[model samples]
Target chain A: MITPGAALSKSAPLLACIGLLCAWQVASLALQTESFPTALEAIRAVPSILGDKESLVNIGASIRRMAIGLSLAVLFAIPLGLLMGRIKGVASFFNPLLMIIYPVPKAALMPIIMLWMGVGDMSKTLVIFLGVSLPIIYHSFQGGKAVEEKMLWSGAAMGLSAPQRMLRIVLPAALPEILTGCRTGLVLALITMVTSEMIARQSGAGNILFNALDMAQYDTVFAMIIIIGAMGILFDAAFEKLRGWLVRWSKPQHDMPLSFS
Target chain B: MKVVSLRSDVQAEPAALPGVAPAMAMIHIDHVSQRFQTSGRQSHLALSDINLTIEDGAFVSILGPSGCGKSTLLYIVGGFVQPSDGAAKVKGKVITGPGPDRGPVFQEFALFPWKNVLGNVMYGLRQQGVKKTDAEAKSRKLLEMVGLKGYENFYPKELSGGMKQRVAIARTLAYNPAVLLMDEPFGALDAHTRTRLQNDLLTIWERDRKTVLFVTHSVEEAVFLSDKVVVMTRSPGSIKVVVDIDLPRPRKRAELLLDPRYQKYVVDIEKLIDDTGEDEIHA
Candidate 1:
């Protein structure tokens, strides 16, 4: 049923991606600098870099940390946000504290965290957790607070108890917004994990990049960068798939090219 | 256009209707007044001394100008709002809060966006602890009654305005409430859809004869679908007139349009609202 134009539109993103890689390859070859590796060189380097056990261990460690940190942040922040959003007493008690701490740069807190917890996995994971939790809490709070008044009245009229209303009506209504928050938290968790790894010289993807740069393994560095970028894209795509499956009732917008019957 | 005085005879004994059984008050609103605090000190009175009685199995429409507290009065009867003075009672019991006994269909068609059509219709029954098999059977029947037989799997967002309201009506009826309170259920629909729904509603009303208190601004709609139309004054609303619509049952829109009696009823209610000197907005 899809038209030619629809097929073309779907391939547009892939075309743009190929175009960007071609431009990067051209620029890198023209410059011929040791610091910059051509796209071909970086692509050639990926197989060797991945095959190496040290680099593989680093990549695995980074992903594992990000997963744990992100999972914990989502688990803790969602409940806290829902409670604060639904109950006036909880909101009043926590609002001032959240406002004050939410904006302080997580990177700036690393030194203090290191001083308290020492330069280890504990401090790095804690930094990532702190960075990720703030946005999740804020967005989930907005989502929980935004349940329509009319919907609440309708639920009440249907003889639903307050708890039943919250579970069946309010929670589902807020889910899309909460998922958006989780996606944002995922990106933040990845960034904070790398930054913490680099600062602490820990065993992770960032540590591999630092070591390769020190040894002048330019191709290896570029290959690691591409791997990290691919991971980010993969995580985002996974979240989008989850959103599509869970919030199936919220239809996606139809902006595709016109198709004849 | 002609004006008739049906108000004088009907106001004397509110329950005295021909062909209906000995009267039993299903909903009794006695001097119900609602005042809302606008700001720190200012208060806006919505309804004032609105006393009315809706007999069991009667279809009554409350007609008024927009923002004249017609919805507030309906909400009070539905127990969604508490009156500042007096009380609204259903079957001799004071209504403190919303219950399944008085089902309400809102103007926005407040359907759950997450649930599909069948799920929304089954929601009340599920909450009331009905078995899944029975609830599904009853819900499917109600959906069929509302002309939404094959649309059971569709979400509220996928439905048209008329369809969404149809789902809301089906959902309300599935719960089997004693008194149905609809606040301008067809207000957002187009004229064609509105008339079709009006006819459909009348058909449904004729079958079950559940007591209905419908609120709307359309004088023609009130005359066509209601047994009695209670017109209210502007702002701090009170009962202005009650026009008893004695039009024969199973009325047809095309035939009723040419009927002189139907025309007179519409004209009378229109004149009563016009006499209030309020500019016509959305009712």
Candidate 2:
């Protein structure tokens, strides 16, 4: 159904991305340096990277750590944030603690976390959890707090109990903000995961890249970097799609543009 | 100044038909007063010693100037606000909090943005333990009653102000509340739409008579929609007069415009507001 003009506009971003890749390839060729692999060299290195069993192990481990850490953080943070936002007593107790902890650079806690838990998956996961949970909690709190007063009154007048109103009205109204929080938290989780991996015993993509760079395996380093970048793009796209599906009801009110990342 | 007695003229005729018993009082506001703390060490009273009785099946409007506590009075009756003194009783039982037995329609058209017309209407029914299928059926019927038959699937944001208010009315009625408390339900609409909704509200009210306590700033709207209009003074509002509209049933806007009795009632209510000399009441 798309006309030529419509198709051109739809494909414009993809075409621009292709153009940028071609320019990178040309620059790599002109430089003729071993450290900076050309796009072709990096793409060719993918087979050997896949052939190496350690690559799969590292990718699997990283994915598992991300899943575990992010899951635990979301499970605890969302409810705590909602409670703090909706209940005066809960907010009074948690507000000071949240304010103090939220601004502290979470990445700076990695050493302390490692000292407490040792250089194990627990430390890495804790680091990721710490980095990710604060943003989600803060955003969810704001989301829950910002539900319109008249909306609450309507819920009350409809004879809904407090719990029912919280579940059916407040939570749904806060979904868009919570989803935004989750998106931001996902990026933080990945960053903390890589940092923890690089600092700890070598298993994830972060360790693989460092190992390749130390050994002067320029092609492998470039390949690992490209793979991590692709993973980040993929996760961002997936979350954006999830957001669209979850919050289609609020599309009219949410004026924010759809972001690529 | 002494509060004028406008009800005397209508009550003198004793207009109840022969075979019908007198209507029972549904909502009783007994010496209610509300005070709000504006800032540190200062408080403003909204309603002062307000007393009124809404008979069962009667459509009554509380007409006043803006910030005159008419809405506060409605909120107290609906159990959303507690009076600093006295209380509001529904069917002789003191209201402690909001319940399914009384529904409120707000001027802001408080339809849930996430819920479409059908879902919004079914919300109260669902809360009251009705099954999903039954709630849907009841919601469909109510939407039809409010002239939103085809818009059941449309979200509140997609609807015009009038249509949204229609959906809000349908949502409130779906729960089958014994009394409907409306606070300027048509206040946000255009003049044309407001007139149309007033007529539609009358039609709907006639079919199923629930005791209604409507609050508004419009003199004409109050006269057009109610069996009685209670006028209140500005700031720390108290009832100035209760004017009875004894116009015949099934009244049309055009026909009522020409009726001398309707004109007399409108002017009398307007004069009540004018006598206060604060602000002119809107149409």
Candidate 3:
């Protein structure tokens, strides 16, 4: 829960970031390891990574794919999830198949998917899509199932047809929960993106980290790690902000992030 | 001056009752029986042969204990639930499903949490294909009538329980439904808010006098607001008695609270309910 001081709550994240870096700087200096660069050294190398046009393009492509994958999953999953939640027959039909697929690592499907779809963006995007879809579907399902019966009845009385009720009533009513799923899915999307790129040795931020490590460019390695870490933090923060606004109507049940990560 | 009586027969005319009524009734529920499959093939009867005729521009309340299926009866009329046996008709036609002709205000308020008060009120009008400007104008008027004028931009969650119910009533009224099916609309509020809303409801109802089917457990509330009170019992819920209020119109709560006739009606209805063995069971 946020305290009474609005300023303190707003600046809490920035303060935490600085505090983490100060700790990292102190620990690296004390350990005195060659491979483990100090926080400042990695910070200095960050410019070179961003300044390089190829690196920027690679990271940009990674983001574009991530955005597309997340959007597609959200579009597909929410409706399916709501249907599953509301209808017993639909739920039963899909439950067994989902159960079988849920346990398998979505990123691990990269190698097999690459074999089938070739080493294109399709395989990578598909993996990310798979990674995020489950959480969104699960959350939307729960949200739809928990909608008040009387709300639908009110909608019915207002001359809303079955489909209209699902859209106007169920969709908005389940939005808070659905947004929670999307937030979790966003975190999963980033994770799956990096992990899949690492496995496939693709041209992404993940590939840059490994390539730098192989060449013994410790600063670049740490710098790449910092960039990816920053991306994750920035993306998560931005998403959390949007989620908060979208679900401002909801009684903020959990102040802490119950992320899939 | 008691025109209505408690007849000995529990079941009303079933044969030819569904269709023969060329009656001027606004809403007619004939021989409606609702049975629920309560776990492992055990079917529990919720409502049994509830034949109710609500005339146009009349205020009727179904008074019963919790789980007596009073709300269920309201839902049947609202066309949200299909009765296991029989049909609810609104103005001579069978209620196949919910329509704009019968609007419902639920106990939970059931206001869209996402939408602000204005948006919620405008929903029915928009659904009915009214132009946006016209819907907005009508919704604003309805909001003012419900006594939540400046609070239109606030979401349902931001409002008090009373305010939320007011918004719900406004939302339902915006559609201009001939029959207002209120299923314990004021039951969730405190006594003070309840009385305030009851007074406000009568003021609003007086203007148009829409046929309202209000369901509640409060005897005083039923007696105060209703033209006729249908006292019901649980465990095979059925209408135990239908008491005609016969009170003068435009009823004022302050005067009615002190009136001997009003007190007697409340007492008589309470006794009827107490005799059903539900007071102990539910309370």
Candidate 4:
């Protein structure tokens, strides 16, 4: 069903990316320096990076950390958001705390977290959790609060109990907003993952990038950058697909244009 | 039509006809007044000294202009909003909160977006502890009654404005409530759809005989549907007049339009609504 125009639109971003790579190649040729790794050199380094068991281990470790931290964040955020959203008094009490803490760089807490939890994986995971949890929680709170009062009244008039109303009406109404929050949280989780690895841990994609820098392996660093970019794009696409599936009942069933990461 | 004759000798004194038994009032609004306190330190009185009694199986319409507290009165009757003074009662019991006995349909067609047509209709029955099979069967029947039998799986977004409103009505009726409170339910629909729905509603009301308290700004709608239209005035809203429509039973839309009586009722209602500077009544 892909028309010529649709095909062209799909390939447009890829074409632009190739053009950027060509420019990089041209610049690398002009420089003709060993320190400046050419596009070909970075492409050749990809297999070696993939072949290295240590690199695979690092990727695995990073994925595991993300999974654990994000899962914890999801668990904590949903209920807290629901609580804060449904109860006005609770929302008012916590609003000031959330506003104050949300903007503060979660990474700044790294040193204190490290001091308390030691230089363990727990500290790194905690940092990532703290960084990712707030956005999800805040978004859920906003989403939950955004449910129309009329909808709630309709449910109540139908003789829905408190729990049934929350589950059947409130939750579905808030799904779109909560999913948007999760999308934002996913990006933040990745950023936090890299940052935590760079500052605290000796494993993950961040560690590989850091080590490449230290060894002056510019081609390997460029290769890792490409891998990271691909990973971010892949995660975003996956989450978007998940969101579409979860909210298919709410949205129109039409193919949407894909966005480059 | 098969008319079953009642045995008048069964009782010492026949109270009334079988259909017009001395039916108890299902919903009673007793001197209910509501006020809103704004942030500007001024209190706005929405409804002032409103008292009305809706008998069981009666179709009453509260006709007024926008912001005339017709909707406020409907909400108070439905127990969604508390009255500042006095109260509303259902079956001699004061309404403190929303319950399945009184179903309300909002003007905005508040169907849950996530739920399809069938799901929305089944919502109330499910909450009432109806078994899944029974609920589905009843919901399907209700949907068919609302002319949405084939659109059970269609989401709210996919439905036309009129279809969505139908789904809302079906959802409310699924609970088998004693009374239905509608707040400008067709106001958002187009003229054609609104008229079609009005006809559909009259048909359903005739079949079900459920009490309905409909609030609307359209005098035509009030005249066409309601047995009695309680016209209210502007700000500090109170019932200005209650015009009884004695049009013949089993009414049809075309017939009502052709009838001069309907036009006269509309004209009188318009005059009453237009007369705004009358002395206010304080309870």
Candidate 5:
């Protein structure tokens, strides 16, 4: 049943990864810069980074914090966003504040947050939480707002109470949009995790990248970049798979696929 | 044209079927009016002092032109929207909000997009605390009744316009509502599909004469499907006339299309609607 287009599209992500590496290989070879290593050297260095116990544990800790931050953000934002969408007063109440906060780079707040709560995992996690919350909330609001009134009426006619209608109808109806929000929030969580770590100079994948740069270990630096990129790709692809399954009934909302492989 | 009239003025109030005791009014929309707040402080009058009594087990169509508040009146009866001035009562009790007593089938179909045909049909039954196994069995039967037996797992987005409406009808019927409020349920379908659904609806209706309050702009649809057609005028919409459809049951489209009585009713209702169009222009 697989169409030719789908088959080609299936391999597209793998093809993209190889193409990027090949391009990087050519560019580094052409430049012949001591600081910039070839793609093969970086790929070779990847085993060393993964084999080191400390680096592995550091990466693990970073991921753990990310999971906590993202989970907390999702818990806080979805209900608030749904309320904002359904009630005009709630939307107006929060709109101005969200607007003021929206444009401020959340990673930039690491320093300020550190001043208040120090540079523990707490401050870094808070930054990730802030980075991830906005998109999910915005999307959930749009999703909840877009729910058809007639659908709620149908639920009501079936003897569903108001809260029952909101829970059973609005939540499921808004799920596709909410998941789209979570997808964006996922990538943002990674970027925020790395950026906040780089800013705070804490122990994580970002710290490894910074430390490699300090000692001029260009291979380690590029290898860490590849590891981070791989994590981003892997997380996004996995999330996309889960999202598709959860909202199988929904029409394809976006054109871009996150590369299944 | 009614501010308040004897219930019979709207239609035969008692609706005494021959050789049967007369049934009580299924719905009493007493002087209901609706005003929508537009931009600025301006308010637009939608329904104007609407008063009508729909008899029990009667198939009544609220036929009108676009923007005539025909659908709004149906919504009022379903208790989705409260009237700005008056109230709508069903079975001698005021309709404060939507309940299982009155189920609505909207033109949009309003099926839960997330639920498959089976889940959509079973929603009401599940909500009513029906056991899982019993609800599943009943939903399958209803799906088969709606000609969607094999499409139990198919989502609403996967179905065509007519099929979706069929599923919607089955979903509302799942809870066994005493009154069915259909707001132009067939308006979105093609001529062929609409015709087929009309016949199918009537066949279903014949089984257990649920009091139906249907709304449609098509005179043909209204006349073909209802026991009475309540013609309405727009822009502060109100009833213009009530035409009793005395056509016999088990109406065959092929034969009814050629029947003089059926053709005459369609033509007369079309004229009535046209007159309202003229009145709208004059106003």
Candidate 6:
């Protein structure tokens, strides 16, 4: 059973969110600008935004793109990471390439991708893929490389074959690091998904936000910002739950004792 | 000139005789020496001119002060390290690398943390391609033998220090190695746990009769577990004495503690160890 404090902690973020919304409402009212909608106006627009089929369709499209790109990134990253991790020569050969390419903004490649793929869904998907793949690959590689020598020796001494050792011992030991990488990659994928839509596509959450901004629908723009924030939080929560399940064995046994005054 | 040459050849014959019948030696440490070379420094000698024989099915303990290469010698026997000068052989076969034939129990109870107690015991058998049903049956039997029957499904983290060592021993013995190398396997346990494990180890060794080469700093432990305790001198270590343990089998802990002979062996070894003053040299 989860502790009472943990349950309370989960909702603390929502409370802070509400407090921010109230503060924004007060400030917007004081400013009295049409460009900055009050919190009440944004809240009133939420139902309309939910009722709008186009906005829902755009959200769906963005999620679909993210799912496809992230799936492809994981598929490619796992094997590449394992290879680079297991073989020193391969790691050395690819190290410079990854280091050179990983840091350059994936958005910077959108124009080139557009030129190649004609500004279609393909180009946006490619941008998200590029942004997500590197971190995943790098983290998995580091994780696999970090397997302790003694653990490997233990496997070897037990007469485990190379393949068995890698699969049973090395992979599980490296899993925590891989999950961390996945978490980071997932956040990057979300950011890049929005950026790709804003720059290249015309049918996603980014497009809706852009349209709302153009029409000076400040309340709708505020609604879009809230949706984006919710999406980020939702994805993070899901990834964390999966990670916790996968690495339950890796956690330390002792929990800190409660102190009462 | 012919008479003088004949006399010299006859005198040199004894030296060559030792090399001719090397196979008869169960474990041959043939002038073996190990050196470690670090960057920008002279090579350090860990072991030097160490020559000894361990008879078949003999229980031997290598007792020495810290940095005396006691553990290094055990590693060499286990085929985990190579000798810089000569060679170590088991039953006339040269020690090249680690194999299932030689099982080693580490001090840290290096059972894989992910596996349950039974799984860890069965690991060696599984690796050797034993069928699951048979391996499981065998593992269960071994676990029962180690007094860990009910706790088979528990992971290493859940077990006590003594229990973990039992699992480690069971894992090593699952391979049915001809020789067992234990490097201070009870060093980390509490006094009570250490004594309990020592007794358990003796029980297991009595039943199996496998050649055991145990390394430890404790003189009493060396005397208690060994058929012969080979006392070693410190730094660039060499065998100083081999004291025979004449105590009978199925010896209880209390009896050994009270026995005058056991006490003498412990005191003698401790005195010899203290006389070396080699601990300061290593420091």
Off by over 4 Å in 4: A1-3, A32-35, A252-261, B1-19, B277-283
- Model 2's lDDT to the true fold? 0.84
lDDT of 3 by residue, A51-105 (tens): 9999998898888889989999999999999999888999999999999999999
lDDT of 5 at A245: 95
Give residue A215's error in model 3 in angstroms.
Answer: 1.3
Give TM per candidate. 0.91, 0.92, 0.92, 0.92, 0.95, 0.84
Tell me the deviation in Å of residue A213 in model 6.
2.4
Candidates by lDDT, descending order: 5, 1, 3, 4, 2, 6
Alpha-carbon lDDT of model 3: 0.86
CAPRI docking class of candidate 4: medium
RMSD of 1: 5.4
Q: Considering the two chains of model 1, state its CAPRI-style docking category.
A: medium
- Report RMSD for candidate 4: 6.3
Tens digits of lDDT, candidate 5, B205-266: 98889999999888788888888899899888988988889888777888889999999999
Chain B TM-score (each prediction, in order)? 0.94, 0.93, 0.90, 0.90, 0.93, 0.88
Lowest summed lDDT across 10 adjacent residues in model 4 chain B is found at: B2-11
lDDT of 1: 0.86
Q: Give per-residue lDDT, candidate 5, residue B90.
A: 88
Better of 2 and 3 by lDDT: 3
Candidate 4, residues A63-82: lDDT per residue as tens digits? 78888988899989877887
Model 5 stretches with alpha carbons more than 4 Å out = A1-10, A257-261, B1-15, B278-283
Model 2 chain A poorest ten-residue lDDT run: A252-261
Candidate 5 chain A lowest-lDDT run of ten: A252-261
- What docking grade applies to model 5? high
Rank all candidate structures by their TM-score, best first, as comma-separated numbers: 5, 4, 3, 2, 1, 6
Q: Give all candidates' CA lDDT scores.
A: 0.86, 0.84, 0.86, 0.84, 0.89, 0.81
DockQ of candidate 1, scored on C-alphas against the true complex (2 decimals): 0.64
Q: Relative to the unseen true structure, what is the C-alpha lDDT of residue A128 in candidate 4, on a scale of 0 to 100?
A: 83
Q: What DockQ do you compute for every candidate structure? A: 0.64, 0.61, 0.84, 0.73, 0.90, 0.44
- lDDT tens string, model 1, A207-232? 98888899999998999888888888
- Runs in model 6 deviating more than 4 A are A1-11, A43-54, A76-95, A253-261, B1-26, B280-283
